[model samples]
Structure formats: structure tokens, C-alpha cells
Target: MALSTNRSPQDTLKIAQVRSANVDGTWAIANKAGIAYSHDPVLGVSVVSKSDWGRLAEELSSSEFKMVKIDSVAASYGALQVWSVQTPRFDNARAQRRHSGLGAIWAVYSDEKSSVPDIQDFTEPVDAVYTWVDSSDPDWQTSYSQFKNSVPAAGSHPTSRDIARYTSRDELKYSLRSLEMNMPWIRQIYLVTAGQTPKWLDTSNTKIKVIDHAEIFESPEDCLPTFNSHAIETQISRISGLSEHFIYVNDDIFFGRPMSPNVFFTGSGSVKYSLAKAHYAEASNPRLAVNLAAKLNAELIEAKYGKTTARKFKHVAHPQRRSIHKLINKAFSAEVQETAKHKFRHVNDVSVPSALAHYVAAAEGVGVPADIDYAYVDLGGNHLPMNLYRLVRGRGMQMFCLNEVASVSENEKRGQLAKRVLDDLFPYKSSFEK
Candidate 1:
């Protein structure tokens, strides 16, 4: 974990004096004046300082810190100060702990521990793939109506929200252009959609391929009029010319900086999974299919595999092996088939892409457990501008996502803000463009 600050070392001490900042493992983050700040940057750590604020930091990490939950504040200085915020902690130890379990699986299989090689240094080309859709497209809007009667009138699967799971703010095209400009080694770019393409996209580019949903869906009965991501995701392996190794991203996701294959796969030819522990005793949101999918992944890993991991994969483009996904689909055909039929997100959906296939690759001695640093902003966020700044600014953010897209009826100012940042980041035209 690397820690960076815009302020000089002397200024860092003046503000709060991060004495013996512990960023070795998991890091931390908190909202201050609507700005997001992650601590020295790692897992579970307390910034020990000689200042009075040091005590406040310790108290906030302790069990008695209830100011954030109740939306109240407490002060101890002459000047009355009010602060109420719930901090988000990062724990890398839990992820590291799984290495032993993964190692045992690998150890029983083979051995090669000489020099560590960076896979990115290799010349083998890797492709970037994305599943994008524009909600406002008349064809798509009409398609949504085709299955409107199947969905309930109201609930978590709301008509106004679920009807447009795939929002097209032109983020995908910008993100694709960023991939072309930043990652020099990034090979063919694949755009998978529900039979829709961005108008701004250059279809004439041979380097780009627009894959239709009808081409990859397993069965004809479950192919058309499909609104389920699980069904769509499960069929990515079936893509005609998809590389043996590729990164799958949603239209909302992007590559913040140039990345090498080594960032994803280790020198040992093993794929890396960016995962976080998100196990729960029981799920409350029944309609949250991604959670259900993660739970399903956990259960599958525990039952068939030799280890137990309650980890959940974040919403980022992940390095996926074509064969590994095929194996996962074969091993869990029934679940995959059921997941495919969901016209919209449902509780029964399985998210094997998150952890299942990656975990299986590890069990078979071709996977690595890794942590990822990425910025994420929901369009509906009040501090979206700040989050977007944190994402594109010179903070060296590598990957990011802009989800929960605003409808046409909603304000387009958010879209403008995001575009401004992207335009500043990648101002040149990519070869993939006309």
C-alpha cells in the first residue's frame, strides 16, 4: 500500500500530525466537509498523534463513538466544534488470511518460487470488454415494455429504476476511448450490448466488435427480451473471439490509468481477484441479486472447495479467464440457467463472476487473491462532484465507476461534470474512433 498527500510533511503534522501512521494492512476513509479522505491508505490503523485531535481519532475508532449514528456531535476544546460522520474501514488482513487457504490448494499441486515476474511486462495482448446499454433508446424502452407485465408494479424492482438498469450517459464510449489511450498493451475492445450501440462509437474500427445479446445467450428461449445481468454475464465466455484472458467491465466502469496484465495476473499465470469480505448472517434485501449471487459464490466455495471465504467482489472490471468461466458454467449449470431467465434482477440470481469463477481458478492453481484501489460515485450522491474529483484528480486512482445514472428527466449537470473530468483526463482521439 502506497500513501500520498498533497500537503508537505510539515503541513501534514500541523493539521492533525499523523504520528506513526499505520497503513500497512487495511486503510480507512471518512467524510469531512463532504470530501472523501482515506487514512494513510491501508487496513485497520490508528493515526497516533501528539495533538488533541489524536484522542478524537482513537475515540472514533472505539465502540463508544456514537456521534455518527445519531447525527449528533461532541467537542472538548475552547472553540465548540461539531462533527458527525461514520467512517469506512478497509481490512486487507482478511484477504491476506485467505492466501494460506489458497496456498495450501496451490502447494498440493506444484511449486516455482524463484524470481517474481510482472505479467504486464509480457507482450501478450489482452482485450477489454464491456456490457453497455442506453436506457432511453426507443428500442430498449420498447423492449422493457415487452416484459413490463412480468415485473411487479412496485417494490425494490421498481418500474422507474429497474426498467433502466443499463444507463447510457456516454460513459462507456469515453471509458473505451480512455482504455485505448492509456493502456498501450490493451488489445481488441469488445462492446457487448442488448443489440444497441452508442451513436458516437465508430463501428468501422476493426479493433472494436459489437457483440449482440442474441449471439451469446445459451438458449433461444432465454435469449431475447432478457434483462438479467447474471444471464448476460454468464455467457461472456461464449463470445466468438474473446481472448483467453480479458477484463469484463460494465458501461459505468472505467480504467483510471494504464494497467498491465501483471496487475491482474501474477507472473505465475494465475488470475487475480479483487475481493472484500462482505459476509452476512442473513440477507435482508431480497431483491439485491448481487448480494444473493455473492452468497451463492460463498456457499459453492465452502461446499465443493476446501476453504471458506465470505468475500464479495466489488463492482469493477475484473480479469477473467475464458476457460475458467466455462468450467464455472458447467459446474453450476442449473444455477446459471436459472439466473439466465431473470428478466430483471431477482433474489435467486447467482453472481459467479464476482468470486465463484475466480475462486475456482485459485482452487485449480491458477488464481491470486488481490486488493484493488478504485473510486466509485453514484450519480444521485450529494457529494458526487467531490467523489468525481477524487476519482480523476492526480491522486493516481487506477479504476473507477459512475453508477446509478440519472434519467433524461433528471439533471444533466452531473453528466456534464463527469464528462468534463474525463475530457480533461483523456483529451485526444483514440485510434478506435473514426
Candidate 2:
């Protein structure tokens, strides 16, 4: 049922900046000028001038405003985490602070007329790449044992250790399907692992290729059997026949909405990176390596560009260019070389391939920071799987990541929940599937 606003169409429409809201809830309704508004249940949100209201009363004796309900608020209330659109996480208004390092310089580069023309098409071939490994693999375990005994950095917290890190959610297959269905602009997908391939993928599909880590390491004898993601990411640029531009994503990340190439790269060829802000606080998450990576990103950007550096990045797909990789390797040859030797994560290690790539690109004038639409959910907590369903059905995200769920002898409930969520999100098999 529509509630009465008693405002005439002529008078309401005459007021250029009108506001409207639900008379029952906080949801903002439509304004007369096609702008947004909210109608308060107790105190109506719409405000019109006296002249307009009098004219409205004369023109239309009875006019009522209908309530708009996007969804039930209870839908997103997680056990602890909320996935509602009302949450600041999904909106750009919550994007981390402005880029502090080389931000101004990059802004100039981005605005330069010569850097990128307005009409350029960014459809040049780009590859999608991921590095994956299941720790349960006997060969992987053997290699891990060899490194664990020799390297002091092989430390793993007993309480925090979970198979969730390497556990396969079958999202890799779905991610491939998403590319095939949503992002046709992608040229190929390279799943990098230790000679392991998902059984369900259609390898015969010429567009997809499985890259073994042995093929990219500079010194196979030293870097082979590596457990550090930073070390492995550093070598991905060396893949043979890889395109000049590529996107790196983890197995858990999936495309939620159809997107185009232009989202990651500007018409002028500058790569876009979404910078996330981190506040000053003691490192608390059990994931110490992530915090170390952010600090390293800040240090490197500050040293070269001489400004405060943004310490965090949105957990999303990474846009990478081969040329920047080469430049960083050459500039930080010794540090990178030493990092490759660390079989496991170390406190001193720099995130050269992950966060550092964006900082380096911006400093060199080849990239600009951009805020993209995406969602992130940590299923390790008690979040309802319905959050996943709602995010897609009401897709405000181009991509989203599912994190932290694993099975064990005692508790398989979380893993089961994750499986159900994935099935619900993408039930149909894509053409890329066997």
C-alpha cells in the first residue's frame, strides 16, 4: 500500500532537489527529479517549499508515495559479520585513504593527454593466471619436509594451521567458467602449480593452459620446492608466451558480475590498482605474513617515491604487466634473489610481486590507482552461506573472494557449508568444463 505524500506531480516535479523515503523504514525512496530520497516512518523525509506544497494541494487532492523494499535487512545479518549493502565495505565511500605515495605524481600521469586517450579500446589480449597447490600432495609434502628441516622460517602456528589455505573449493573450475561466460576479453588462463591439474577442467580447450612452477623459476635448484607465495608470484612473469598484460587471482576469488577489459586497464593503456587503506594498529590477525606484506609495500614506495605510502590493498584480483616485473627484478636484484631463497615466508621478505607491483607501476607512470566494485567474505567465521547468494543475486561486485574454510576429522561443517554456497552460486557447468 502506498502512503500519502499529498504533493501534486506538477509542484513536486517543480522542486528540482526533492527527497523521498519510506514512511515505514529507512530505505531511501525516489525523488521527483529521479534523484534518491528516504521517507521517515514518523517524520516524512520529503521536503517541499510552501509555494510548491500549496500548488500541489490545489492540483492533486490525494497523492501517495509507495514504499521501496530492496530486501529484508535480516537477510545479511551474519552470526558476527554482516553482508548488507548498507555496510560501508561494499561502497566506495569506505575506500582506504588517498594514495599517499606517488599518488600526486600518478594523478598527473593519469590526467596527461598523451598518457591515455579517451577513446582507446583496452581489448588487447590479457591472460588470467593463478598459482595453486594442495599441501596434501605426497610430492609437495616431501618437498616441504626437505625445506622445513633446513629453513628456520618454516614456522607454522599449531593452533592457526588449517588445510583451508590449500584446500580446493572447486572454485578454480568455476572461475574459469566465469571468464568464459562473463569476460570474453580474456585471451587465456594459466593455472600454475607443481604439475597438478584439476581433474574436471577441459585441458583440450586451447584457451586454458596449466603451467608448472619448474618452468618459471630462475634457478630451479634453489627455488624449486618453494612454499612462499611471494617467491612463487615473483616468478610468474617469466611464463613463456604469457601476454604483456595479465590478471592474477587466487582459486577462491570468483567473478560475480559481468565485466569488461576496460575496468582493469584504462583506454590509454595505464593499468588500474585499487589501493586499500590500513590504520595504525598492532598486527593482530593470525595472518602475520599479510601485515608484513603491507608494511613492506609502504617502505618500498616511500623509499623510492619519497612520500607516505598506502599500506593496504583490497583483496581482489591483481592487474599485472610483464614490463614492470622485469624492471623491479632488475632494480632490486639482490633482495629479490635472496627472497627466492626463502623456502617459506620470512619477516624480512618484501611482497615484490603482489603489493609492490602496483606501487612500482604507479611510480613509473604506467599505472594509476582505481577503486573497483568487489566483495570479500571470510567464511572461516560463522557467516551464513546466504550472504554469498545475496551478493550475487544483487551483484554490486565485479568479483568477490571466499576465504577460510576447511575440513578435519572432527569438524567438517564449515567445509560442507562452503560447498553448498559454491553450488548455489554457480550450479551450471560452463563450456570450459569437461
- TM-score per candidate, chains pooled: 0.67, 0.68
Q: Please report, as a residue range, the 10-residue window in candidate 1 with the lowest summed lDDT.
A: 101-110
lDDT of 1 by residue, 1-434 (tens): 22245543222321011212222111232222122222211111122222323344454456222222110011111112222222122112322121111100000001222112223333345777787777788988887887776666433234334554566667776677556533545567788888887776779978789998888888847556777676688888888988888888776776654344556766555778877555533546533656666776767777777687666677777888888988888887888887777677666667766567888888888888887767778877789778876665443345677777445337778778888776655444555554
Q: List the residue pairs that clash in candidate 2.
A: 20-37, 20-38, 21-38, 21-39, 22-39, 29-37
> Model 2, range 2-51, lDDT digits (tens) per residue?
32245532223211111211111122221332333222121111222333
Model 1 ranges with Cα > 4 A deviation: 1-123, 151-161, 280-287, 405-409
Looking at model 1, how many pairs of residues clash? 7
Instruction: Give the alpha-carbon lDDT of every model.
Output: 0.56, 0.57
